[model samples]
Target: MTTTSLPIVSTCGTTGCSYNHDSDCHAGAITVTQGCGTYVDVAGEAGIDTRAQVGACHRSECVHNTALECGADSVAIGPSGGVADCLTFATA
Candidate 1:
């Protein structure tokens, strides 16, 4: 038998995001598109202490995306205009 862990959010630089605290994401799960689709602009907390994992990825061009899911060991997010972008994304 084998087990694998979901790709976790290793770091986040979107300070304006509600789920971001000290460059860490507490959103539980995040969606990756050209930017983070799960990003929230409000100033608050997700009320969760756990780090985020890639729930779904919409960038089929990203090498780390396997069947709309992140297959990397981990992922990083950063601010992009008013949203968050997947910094770990690479062209397939």
Candidate 2:
């Protein structure tokens, strides 16, 4: 099923990230890491827009992931390993 919207990008939710703003990501693309880059802190995540699309993802085992890229229309990112991470990651 389609996840992201047309233009609005599902930004990251990671705090202290260079691309994170009000719990939203503002990067052209993002790379999801294993372990430390998964899970969405809904409580911590803010300003999340469902109309965002996933530019690129690295969760190989994610159901919405394909070849290190996100198949989901959009994604949510957050803090992981001191970096912005994908919050929409789900096991395949």
Candidate 3:
């Protein structure tokens, strides 16, 4: 039987997230780094365009895991190993 692929969605629910653009996380495929923190926090105002300082991908089991691109619909970002960021995340 042929199976259809379901749409994947992610969202950055952090208090002050900089990876969100119009409620969308445009940050490329993120990977985990050797350091403790895997993300760079941006300071300014909410709903404003901010930059996501590349860090690392805590989710090692992500389906879009690759050396070049993140095939997953979105990525969860937050503390190391925590669900948070995404590329195709939509706001509810």
Identify the candidate with maximal lDDT.
1
lDDT of 1 by residue, 1-92 (tens): 01247888999998778889889999878888789988887756773888988888999988887778788899999975546889998994
Candidate 3: deviation at residue 6, Å? 17
lDDT of 2 at 89: 67
Evaluate residue 4 in candidate 2 and report its C-alpha lDDT on the 0 to 100 scale: 39
Model 2 spans with C-alpha error above 4 angstroms: 1-11, 35-53, 79-83
Write down the lDDT of every candidate, Cα atoms only.
Answer: 0.84, 0.52, 0.38
TM-score of 1: 0.88
Candidate 1 — which pairs collide?
none
Q: Rank the candidates by lDDT, best first.
A: 1, 2, 3
* Sliding window of 10 residues with minimal summed lDDT for model 3: 1-10
How badly does each model clash, as a count of residue pairs? Answer: 0, 12, 11
Which has the better lDDT: candidate 1, or candidate 2?
Answer: 1
Quote each prediction's TM-score: 0.88, 0.56, 0.35
